[model samples]
Target: MKNRIWIVCLACLWLVNNGVFSQEVSPRSVFSLNEGWECRPITTVSKKALFTPVTIPHTWNTSYSEGTILYDRKMMVYQRPLEITNAMKGKRLFLYFEGVNSAAQVFLNHRTIGEHLGGYTAFCFEITDQVKEGENLLEVWASNAYRTDILPISGDFNICGGIHRPCHLIVTGQDCISPLFYASPGVFIHQENISEKEAGIRVETHLSLKNKKEGLKLKTTVTDADNKVVANSETAVTDSIVKQPMLVNRPVLWDGKKNPYLYTVTVELYDGNQLKDRMVQRTGFRYFSADHEKGFFLNGKYLNLYGFCRHEDAKGKGSALLPEDYKMDMELIKESGATAMRLAHYPHAEPMYDLSDENGIILWTEIPMCGPGGQAFTGLVDTEGFKENARLAVKELVYQKFNHPSICFWGICNEILVSDGKKFVEYDDPIPFIKELNGLYKSIDASRLTALATCVDQSYYLGSSDLIAWNKYFGWYKDAAPSASKFFDDCKNTSKGIPVGVSEYGGGASVNHHQWPLAMEDRADSHFHPEEAQTFCHEGNWESFAKRPYLWAKFIWVFADFPSYMRQEGEVDGYNDKGLVTQDRKIKKDAFYFYKANWNLEPMVYITSRRFVKRDNPLTDIKVFTNLKEATLYINDEKIGTMKPDEMKRVIWKDIKLNEGRNTIRVEGKNGRGFLSDSCEWYYIGK
Candidate 1:
């Protein structure tokens, strides 16, 4: 394999003493660096690949195989010019990249500034000493090559390379908030004795100043949703921080999905009564605790978390998604009545956290230190210096997302031993690695708890974290329902310890594949993965989950089908078809509505297998997932007696005779508040 780097910026014109700007723009300014970037792969053999235009938050994998992992693991070089004036002589300038994956080598004026490992976290470089008052070159080399030291060691997802996230140029005065720590907001809010009546909030602000300045004051104000000031405090920047407390008489609680009220906290820096810098942060007041016996209690209400895990990949876009994509995904999850979500295996884009906050959806986010040895072929080998890389990823994930009220738990690891059976080499135990990561998380933020996701055969490791989650595929893999009852019975008797939950569970199915007779046995390894099998698996799993009130949370394996290179079992060769929704997100599988019927409070009725139109049976067991108590079924204009839903919210009408041709089946019912109606057309051929 040949290695090369592209000289992306062919001609970076510099500002000539430069008349571009008269005065040094504004003090402490931040500008978007999304434009004027030209890039080309090092293997470019023609003028077409010679310094082509590209944008920030881009990926070279856009042109690669969307259905599988045939992505080109090449290096992409990006460059842009920065215009500086004489007024910025004393101020410090910094460049911030929200995320860049496998690795990034940053340069200024053709000199290497620094390099960052791990593609999912934010990093910044201080360039005040290297930048000039005119045009300067800002070049970066990014790659998605598989390395021995990065996490994901191996997973079912595609890792694309580029400056795949937003980048910005930040300018700050000598006395301002510090952007040194993972490019995070310098302020951290700590709430104590939190409730509706009264609460205490401590504001911790870290500042970076050029010199020892005098008469610098930090003013803080807490405002509610109505823009009314609730609490106010101000103090001098005697040191690098101004830690103070603000007490409110009555606070509005940020209840999930019910009422997601948010409050804005603004911080201002003043030098001798002149405002120097300002930062506005949004947060909400809420408190939650989990019990293995009572499930999760948020703001003194038992709110069961019926959620699903989400991946950041999209069709043809790879990991590079727009704000509109985020909104659409958020709306879909919200529409499914998912009260919580697990940002699986890694930290998602920052915008997702905000979307969760706005929609009142609880989040369980984690670093990419997942599944034994990180990637494939290691069989549980932590060869990538996973502990250190994980340390940095954890720091970035917590700090950048600390203020978001939607975040409920921090995941330390996921199925670290899922491949423990394939261990071909001797390796250190993962128990200590997970424990140290948990300790590191505790040292920074104690406001939230940390959890670990593990597959079966790792229950003994549950004592390492604040919470434990298991990814079991009992029905799909073991040909039976999940052992949630045994798990709860074994762990629920404890006094007050870690709570348990189901992190990943579901059978895979392609939207186009269907099993007419709904055979539920000996089909685990079937190449013709059927949509009906996925529906059956979900029904049994939900039935188990509904009975076990001791379980705290349940995050389905995935919400959408995602890309995977090594996957060949499902109908799609290069994708994981475990998602409840299709890869294109154009159709929701029957399993999606199974959970909706149980979780959604709205009056709804839907006949499962509406997409399984072709059938070869005279007698069919028609199933309708409905919140309605009693629903009447009619086939070919003939009533089939009204039936009440079972405890699982399912109305099953068995042995329904179908017509020779297309048959119209309709179901109508009324719930506590409204009426529900559903109809499906099925073509019946001779059995």
Candidate 2:
């Protein structure tokens, strides 16, 4: 009993010195304050409104149904009780907001701590002296109203208003890893001196000092994927920013769909051998670049980056996504055979980048500077407030996500020409601002290439960024049926050695609608925007991509249907049905199969236009997508024919006779391993 008491006392002393308690054993430095929060919209600030229980990964937008959902545009306050115990006496306390729509002001015990603008990025406030040893009141004022000073003042997607992300109460020793700069993972690991044999790993950590300034030891250790320590470095704290370089011999590169080798870097701060604070960062080493002549190259191997853009939103969660949601998204993306992603419009949750790193997915991440007209170029060319805010947003974006290896492009601004003064085609140039943003990006992160997404007219502001991407939907909107490569070919001629990419493309599709023989190229008038038409669009567009060598990346407009409150075009009420898959992701449209057939190295076959189950004509074309060399077709248990895939990886039996009532069609193919088959049932009612 006496020995047990001594052991307990020693353990208590050790934990006290480490600035951690029993409740925080899992997340030693961070405690998720996701539970026990009350929130309500604020009409009158006095006495505040009575609050209902809510969780952190929640949004008031979820309370409204499908078409009834309204963008509140009002300020809401969330209050919760935080327990600051006697154990956390000297440790610095930080209230970390993962995300809050538009703007937010944090208060600790009725005292204003700090305010952070821009809803996408994470930010924190130091609340050391503002709390008591017991329970304290923590309040956050969040709003999604139109802020002229914010980056995304106007956008197609609704800016959900609330603490629409996880918040954490971080406790750190006086000499721990700093969350000072935009609440980032203060430690950034840069992969340098790349080769097949050896690589130079540079670890940079920014530290925060409170009562104790010196006599601190910073140790950085890199562990391989197998949890084997590869390299370790320790140095005495001489400055706020510490740079420790480690040489990794025979480094395993992070190859896409091959081997996503990762190294976990653990940064620990110790005073006299007692652990003060610690932070674990997951990172990988790889080399990638986009070429003007040839497409993109990874690890010195040329490869085309084809994928889709994604929004950090779910069915009911708005943008208040969980780690599981992100994980599922990654799994879906992987299943779709996409090698890369464009996290369009805004910086997503941190776990997204981590998942991409683990799954070997390349990424093109950007800020929410989309759809042209904002305070920056709304009639007047430049507003001081807008410029400063834009700069700050870019700074936070680059600084916070600098360590992720999956990101290859830091997209500066997107489709600014929409708000280019008076006209969409011709207006005040936002190139200066673009250039300023690019410069700001380069000032902090020189590792990745910078880019801008343009939709209106690339000629007006294409010269600002290092690389440019076009969100052109020529066939769907105003132009003739694709010749999808036409615009890219024209741009490539005048690219002036600069790489060009197709950032956003493709038309909407209603899973509820279907067309016979696939809609024509110019199907814009097709109000329902049939699913087959969407499939045809993707097929033609990918054919163009296969023919062209200049288009560096091809990201479909979106991966899944997303909500656009003011949108009234597609079959869905308030949703943009441009996704290759349905909003719920329960259905993968034929367009999704077309890409998988061409891109995915997996063994599978799928029949197109299966949703067009009721055919009026007995003689109709049957189409199937397979990466297999050839496929055997059978109609109503009778072998029809055996054919090879065409230039588009499609096997089509044209004008096949269908039975009178129900027609059973089965297609079999040989993959790399063995036989793969797909079957669909169709009703042939004579017209």
Candidate 3:
């Protein structure tokens, strides 16, 4: 039975992948280079270089000592033995690295082939002339050391070292679609104009030709969700580029979370009659805009973006994760009823973007120009090298992710200011650089908008980007909870009208700690982050955010706790506990259900403060989070009063008496779809 079940699961997975953008039939042959690699860290006074067998999707930070923030920021040398066959002699061979740390240098047969500066983006190196048809040595020297030129000079998250993402060996025809253009797929599909009546499309194919020959033409085809060809065109390959335009009448739109229809794009290069190279990708036709007085609109409809900011790091894996891990995270996000996600601090793995496209979850992806938070200082510098590197990183981010329709906003930076004695200071003027990045993104793709996450109270970079969001922590940091609305109003009352948002809000949480009266004091940097405090912070924050439509989007500070080398104040050190869910992806905090009850349409009844099992006060309030209209409270299986939830989906029974010993607390509710119930036990010490 187990074997049969496994086979069924495999079959289902194959069906799903085939239904999506996986290539049906392709001429290119791609191989995984993820296994059997010997790694060693370079040292100053080395006695012996003992290499350890490691995998491609591996990181050295996983072995860091627990409760310590220090990671081994050394240059790691990974070597692998490759045997080239005679059949692959005539084909163009390339090595593609999805991500390597801060820098990487590739060597073939002890000779340097290529080097890349940025870490979070993808890059490829051609190895056609460097290899023979026998055993060859491939070496990659990866380093994560702090560099002044890198955009993220300082961030709250750790810069994990090693080859943290996948690497592939691609072999294709000599005259085929080039994959060397910043490691992109060499094919870009543009939704020139989209509407319910007609859709305009332009397909650009980048080619690598050996000779200028006649009868070489490119064919582009678009297929709808039902595998029906919607539009098709052909154009001659001229000067290593082919552009074809087509139109579809009465097109099906890719709406957000409503329909999310998609169209498959296939580009084939043919020399007269024979096919040479083929590429397959997915794209959707949609239009959106952000109005200052109004809110975000998608496909001529308003969409209030309420989601979470996510970091790619996990508990044991650090930033190195497999495709399955990303898929799991996507499932969790969908389950929580989120319509959008903010890929914060850095560009995540490619699978994350693909999942967003497939699941129709809007994304706000960004580059790694993260700013300093606490003791860390330097964010932006006025050096030529730093400016040049930042320029390249922004361009690469825009070009590589040009075709993903799910990405609607390009975030330039996050919290780009340093604290200076109760005031924040920007030592170097960041407006010029911000304008440069904003212009670069618009030059590449003008369909989407650009955003910046600032921590300063006012609209400092107001005209720098298309939108501006303040990362304010009112109740958790210093001011009272109700002050958030006043702050938003203050920003709106200013002269310039710019689309505003709440980029980061909420407080830290630890499941172990519990307080009855809910400590209203500020403990932003302390280790006593009770679970109730996080719940209270969200309850207040959402109350203000829900009533204001001018606030375009509100992204919770984080979706899951992540590793931060500078943080040492939580249930465990070296982690930021501001996430709605734990780092291991195991437990969802009480605050997680609070948002689920309000945002998700699925019927659910969750008893908050269940982790606070031991209670000293016999008379306490019973709070239940349920999307249902009304829920009934039962104490020790006895009948209690049924109450309706408020506008925030919160139902509370005030001052309920409990048994002296263990008391059974349960809440049952139902919606039009189905019924749900949740139960927990609380042991009363004193009665």
Q: Which residue segments of model 3 deviate by more than 4 Å?
A: 1-25, 44-48, 418-422, 672-674
Please report, in order, the local distance difference test score of every candidate based on alpha carbons. 0.81, 0.81, 0.86
Q: Worst lDDT window (10 residues) for model 3?
A: 17-26
Index of the highest-TM-score prediction: 3
For each candidate in turn, the TM-score is 0.90, 0.92, 0.94
Model 1 Cα lDDT, one tens digit per residue, 475-495: 787557656556555655542
530 Cα displacement, candidate 1 (Å): 1.3
lDDT of model 3, residue 284 = 85
Query: In candidate 1, how many Å is residue 495 off?
Result: 11
Instruction: Write model 2 residue lDDT over 1-687, tens digit each, in one string.
Output: 999999999999988776665333322467889999998877765674578899987777653453474557889888999998888888888888888887898888888999999899999888888889999999999988877788786666777888988999898776678897778888888776777888797899898866565568798998888999889999998887889999988888888778888888999876655677788888778888888889899889987788999987788788888888888888889988898899978999889998988888899999887763322334223677777878888888888888888898998877676444555544445678788889889888887889888775666665688788888775677564366667788888787878989998898898778777654655444457888777777777888887876688989988989887656676755677888877677888888888888888887789987877888877788889988889999888899999999988999899888899998889998766779999989998888
Q: How high is the lDDT of residue 304 in model 3?
A: 88
Note the residue pairs that clash in candidate 2. none
Instruction: Give the TM-score comparing model 1 with the true structure, all chains together.
Output: 0.90
Best by lDDT: 3
Which stretches in model 1 have alpha-carbon errors above 4 Å?
1-27, 43-49, 62-69, 85-91, 372-384, 418-426, 491-496, 522-525, 671-675
